[model samples]
Target: MAAVGYTSGDPRKVNDTGDTLTGGLVLSGGGSNLTVGGSGAVTGDLSVAGRLSAAGVALPTTFPGRRAPFRDPTRIVTHFQTGHGWATSGGVDAPTTNLNDTTDFAKGTQAAKVVFTGNGNLDISGLSSIDLTGKAIRFQVKVDDASKLSQLNIRVGTSTTNNFQWQTLASTATSKLYRSGEWTTVTVGWADVHGGAGTFSLDANRVPSATTGFTFIRFQVVATGGNCTVHFQSVEVIDNVSATFPNGVVSLVFDDSWDSQYALARPKMDQYSYRGTNYQIVERVGQAGRLTLPQLRTLQDQSGWEIAGHAYTTAIHDSRLTAFTARQVDDELRNLRAWLVANGFHGDSYAYPGGQFESTTDGASIEQIVSRYFSSGRTVLSGYGASTNVLSEQYPPPRPYRILALSGISDASGGQGLVSSLVAAGGELDTCKRLGSWLILTFHVLTTGSTGGDDGVITQANFNTLIDAINSYGIPVKTVADVMRYYT
Candidate 1:
């Protein structure tokens, strides 16, 4: 039978076996499969239904497979104890043999063992050539009796006369402690070790210049109470970098049971699948112009919003709790908790009413009460200066409780303006993305009509726009409870 070439316009039929397609070929029929016997190029996206096989084919070396090599800018400049390049000073005695075979060594087979006798000290050097500029030094050590060792210090500088010293027993956030009979890692940042005087006089912000990089690095151990033996190993200089955030988080908190939030703002948030927190004053529930129990419960169950405790009465904010007696503050918190429990709410968080609190007088008492009841408590922008303000800074290390600083969306005179608020919100979001930090933005009322002079009311349109902006940034929105869980 002769092969027939149909030239009809019907796509069901291949017009000619020898014909070339100028534009492209489209296979639209159901369950139709096309096979290419030779190499082919797809300039656009190619959708595949079944498995793609390229066995025995010579593929391009740059073809996408695993991700390309990514070397983190933060890394170790030098590593020691792998071989010999060590020296010791003072009356201290160095280990006679390699201690790598012993289980006491943290890493590698070789370690520096210093024996402290009476009031004498040991100074270990030889890392003078390696650059310690803007880098932190870390080493592992095991002590026979940590109590007997009076002090352990590290000195780094361009020269002996230009040295800056840091004491390990200072108990700063970066300080490390040595445990008795067990290996403990000690990390000291260069910024923390700067003594602010000497020939080097390294500033906290300045790194060592190329020409005058640190030429001396020493570890000194002083035995005050008694003599002890210490094993040190795995000395390294590492760059200090901010911790990476797993997707960058933003937590939305609505203070006070403002009626506009339940009516105007929540629906817009629901449209985008975002959840916020409502810090409710139990006394305001079922009031004439505030969020009722039904509304709060609906937000909690349907909208996936968190309902946390505020204060019992509208007259007292968290900061003003200092004015009230200790008994009064305790009563209000207890009542708020009871009200939440009776109303079928499981709140594990609290927010300061006005972000004001007296830390000296009743602050400790209030914190103690909050700690006993809730997992976390939040406060408004307490610190005034930009440097001291928590919201303006990057997310700090995790703590059991955080005085979450907030940036108000309202104007300085206390009026809700979309343009300024959006600018402020975007800046906060950018900071969070840059530092991989957690940002908590506080919102109050969402209203179309103003409450006369109320500064907290945000229009629905502006609210939606703000939410869209946050969504465009690809930042994950979390509730107060979620943040507490993550940080704690």
Candidate 2:
């Protein structure tokens, strides 16, 4: 029943007394080969807990044609369980550290409650100086009433005055990540933060050196003429911020089949010898302000673009997967794919209408239904709002039926868009190149102005600027289908 003895000759030579190892056998302790005799059979079950190896070489957990688990390189900065030399400034009260705050905590039974007395920061320091190059700062925040707070910022530096900060409320992409009465995880990447007056130097010395290290990281909160309370947890530095693609791959996906995108953006795309994916709502084709059927054909037959599926209803909002009933959801997906195939488009890939759809809800029925008709389904948000380093699809996404994408592109203004600035977009490209991930940039409308001026609109000049940057990066700009084919 139980035979656990090892001989020296064969590394882990198990001396079995019974014909069958009843419970199970675990081969451990410096073994190069798991030699079940040449013609022997694995009668019952053999479980390798750590890893399986052969001929003194370890075998890969991930093989070709399958996605690999993310290499998580996470360094914990704090969990607010202990008084780790934390302090407050600018009239802010000191953190009320709680070791058993079950009612107000994000992770463990520990959380830090901070009341914003005025306009100031709650900071922690005395770190061992770790290099934060190509890393991101992630944390969870739960506010008593988020609407009461006018602004929130995550800052890092060698000192209070010498730091780089990202205003979460300054951008639309990041602003959505904040919601009161619930915990929100915020991720700020290395390239997203900017220096202020008398702060750290630019680029060369922006990130604290291994010697100098980071002195303190603070959450700066601004109230709308009153005080507010917030809880913090799980502050971490993530090194493997994104999954690696073979190389940086960019996919320009224009949703809704906007006539402006086809007319204004297509030519610019052609100028750069690039193609895009057009997620057309079936009912919108030939409708005023939308791409006509012929225009969609030209994009496919002439421009080398992928005309993918989007919606089937007369209006997109009516077809939103999140708002649909089970019957409606089934009808929408089935009808939408049928229309795409009938209209001579790639009906294989799908873009959820309004960037709506869930893979985990409803027993993953929506995802399963989508998978029935489409090879891949794309969504607008991947949950890491505005952090370019973490904004990309894994080479072979864990969920092919529900692929993740970054939405919105606009001129650097209120930081309302995903790629609000040239630097942000460049950061995304750099991340893709460094991590070998896929950067799928979503667009809606194209205009001719310095600023995008409205939601979902990127000015013509800015669109051109994006194209120039993509070209400069030397990354292959492929259509969604093409990228899927190459990777899959």
Candidate 3:
């Protein structure tokens, strides 16, 4: 039987299973069996009971039953065996005879030891097909004399034509990656590898040897002062999962130890599974319209509320603090510290009264005094925790002591009368979610009176709204001490 179809704008003839076709043809029929004597292409899925053969046929863009590209969590590229595929050049001595040393092993029993007569290097080839974007390279190294080497250089590329080089010192400027006379695991982010200064310049597209995949990685030790021995082991390429922060962090800080905080806010916060820090003014602990010492202790012991220091009196306000002498500032801080300690409240967080401190005028002297008594201090500004921000930004050494900044839930006059303030606080919470920062909110009185009163008071209804809004974000409410512990 003949099958009918057209090819190249011309009609052609095809025969049944046993017959041969001399020209290109398309087969269509109700029967199950059809055969082609020449090359053929099928666009739809095909099923066959017997084997199908396609010689000199181009592979499809994607083949069925093909596994995903291989990715090992710790893909060890080399263990430095003698006559291993690795190539060495440039004043590098041959592999050391003593390969196994318990004192200097990072992974296997053997390692590659290279002594630099001058400047020496080693090149790892044959890895040109792997995708290395967002990957990190790690290796363990021990230096006989760190002072002899100026910097360790790392270069990665697609073959040798295109590459980027980075030095250990570049990362050391921002991170603590290098330690002298010790086994240090050096992990280099692939993104940090760039072509400039010590690296090879790339094309305009910034593609590092795009023609071939990244196959060449080189480790070079440049000699500066003298000769040194370096041991290398467990060279690996790891999938880089960059460090990240939680969704957000919220801290509810109530200042002045107001009676409403103990009577009104505490119940609502407890109902929502939340807690806050109350900066108690030592002098106003037991008077009217303030939390009593027993109430403060109850909040601390039972409710998990932090009773932090907020100075001895209102005389420490910003405007007033500018007039107070250094002795006066010392007296207020000392007395508050003594009171909190004596009351069995061993909390190490302090808040500036009215968000005011002598540091505004006396500079480091006032901050020095506050630091002497507390682990951390709080200000009425908006920022993340000090250590967290510094570590996230990868700031240089000698991190500064972070003074927690507060984003007030109340209006400029320190009252929560306006509904807009609540909306704005929600926006601040969203910002924290995006930046993974902390949002410290300040509130005073939670009474049922005028919402925007001058005494820094808000209605209990608005206080619950703010608390619910914070809850909706699902951010953890942490006390000042908890936050300090998190970063520490």
Candidate 4:
């Protein structure tokens, strides 16, 4: 029989040698697959780094990195490992540029680096038409210091004078929040570049038309306070893999099980025949200021809402999943999901308690544990203002466990009044309609009066107006689970 005490990462080996073992065995290692042959039977748990095939059938294994859905091959722009025909110009100080900086990069040995002191752009011009239809621009960017940077814009067009622009720092409000020294992977779809600091709209320019594909791509930086060094790596356009909704798709997700959500928001949503997703904190079901068990069931059974899982513990804490051992995370997720299933609630979807999926706290393993219990995990807004996650998740989400949502709708940047919210929602809806992407709008508490205060609290009137506006757009409003099913 094979060794019984072997565990994952253990430097132990087991060779069958045509032996028919009767006892259970444990097989695990770094990128090693264990096979059972010659009437060998393993009745215990098996841990594997790669696939485990028995009888020519691949056994179910948790390959954390392979959870992403298959995607079409990506089109390359430049890897910056070799000579690239890019140049720089137009600045007060004439910013320095290098196409092959060996020191900083996301892939290969080198990357295109720029040292900016004023307004300038790094661009490659006079190129053959490269079709960008149904494609998105993705790259890894690292700013030495984002505080000194005023703005950074990504432009694509025939030239600098006529193109669609998207001010990365301005549009996402990352200028004030993303003050770090890490490489951030940014993905921008065609719809993302429609407005926001652009000279013209994508439809008016006929830029990505079949006759005239895009000819140039530029990275413009404005730095006035001080000099900032930025690195760009693995810049390319990839086939847009997100599902397209003809009229767009919206998922109204309410965080926490606040009583106000069941009492006030439910009624408003019910009036329009709308349903929502409630990411309930399992431990707070019957707590004060929270929804009771009966109310939650009503939302799911009678109102047709989805009661998803969130905050596995009784008290919601930051980094709850990441601040523990892998075994602990597994237990927490397993128990929470078990409670939901036993209580007759559909618990396939989840949301991070405080957007705690960070490398600093071993959040990757937490995600693996989360994926074990949930079909999808909705992340907090902008990685809770501390991460590099995007504002909205694309359909067929690159990472189902890291699904991004649009939140903080009451913030200054998002605009306050009902009119402002409506306008902002309309703009988001426009992008969805154009791209057939998904938008998950998250809210926390519902109040009867006042529209300004916390990002989590939205007045009932504004909430009603938001729902009415969504209905007016003629888009399909669905719960999170429903959207995931439709896309997957």
TM-score of each: 0.49, 0.58, 0.46, 0.68
Which regions in candidate 3 have their CA more than 4 angstroms from the true location? 1-245, 317-319, 358-364, 383-404, 411-426, 453-455
Clashing pairs in model 4?
244-436, 245-436
lDDT against the true structure, per candidate, is 0.55, 0.64, 0.57, 0.65
Candidate 3 vs 4: which has more lDDT: 4
Give one digit per residue, the lDDT tens place, for model 3 in 240-321.
4222235556678888878889898999899876878888777777888889988998899989988888877765643444
**Could you report the Cα RMSD, in angstroms, for every candidate shown?**
20.4, 14.4, 28.3, 8.2
Error of 1 at 367 (Å): 0.9
Which 10 consecutive residues of model 3 have the lowest summed lDDT? 390-399
Candidate with maximal TM-score: 4
lDDT per residue as tens, model 1, 147-201 = 7776676666654556766565511121114546766555554323424336655
Model 1 misplaced stretches (Cα beyond 4 Å): 1-244, 359-364, 382-399, 411-426, 449-454
How would you encode candidate 4's per-residue C-alpha lDDT over 1-488 as one tens digit per residue?
A: 53544455664455454323355544332314444443433345544543345675343222222234434435788776777788887662443566688877878899888888788788988777777666666666778887777767788777777776655662233213233476766666654553422344544321223313778888888886677777877677766634346665788888888999999899999988799999878778899999999999999999999887887686434445656765556556666776777788874688877665533244345666677777887776442211222235555565676676776555324332223543353355555655545778888888887663456787787787777877777778888777767543
TM-score of 4: 0.68
Backbone steric clashes in candidate 2, count: 6
2 or 3, greater by TM-score: 2
**Highest lDDT model number:** 4
What lDDT tens digits, residue by residue, belong to model 2 across residues 1-488?
24343322454335453223444444433333345432333333455554355564344322222232333335888887766556667756555533335567766676877778668777877676755655666677887787677667877877777766666662233223355666766655543444443445544323322212676787888866566777877677764233233445788899887999888999999998799998878877898999998998889998988888788776544446766655566666667776777776763578877665643225335666666667777877643333433345544444465466767677645533545343343466654654345678889888876677546888888888788877876778988777677541
Candidate 2 error regions (>4 Å): 1-71, 82-100, 170-175, 196-199, 203-212, 225-227, 240-250, 259-275, 286-310, 316-442, 445-466, 475-488
Candidates sorted by lDDT, best first:
4, 2, 3, 1
Clashing pairs in 3: none
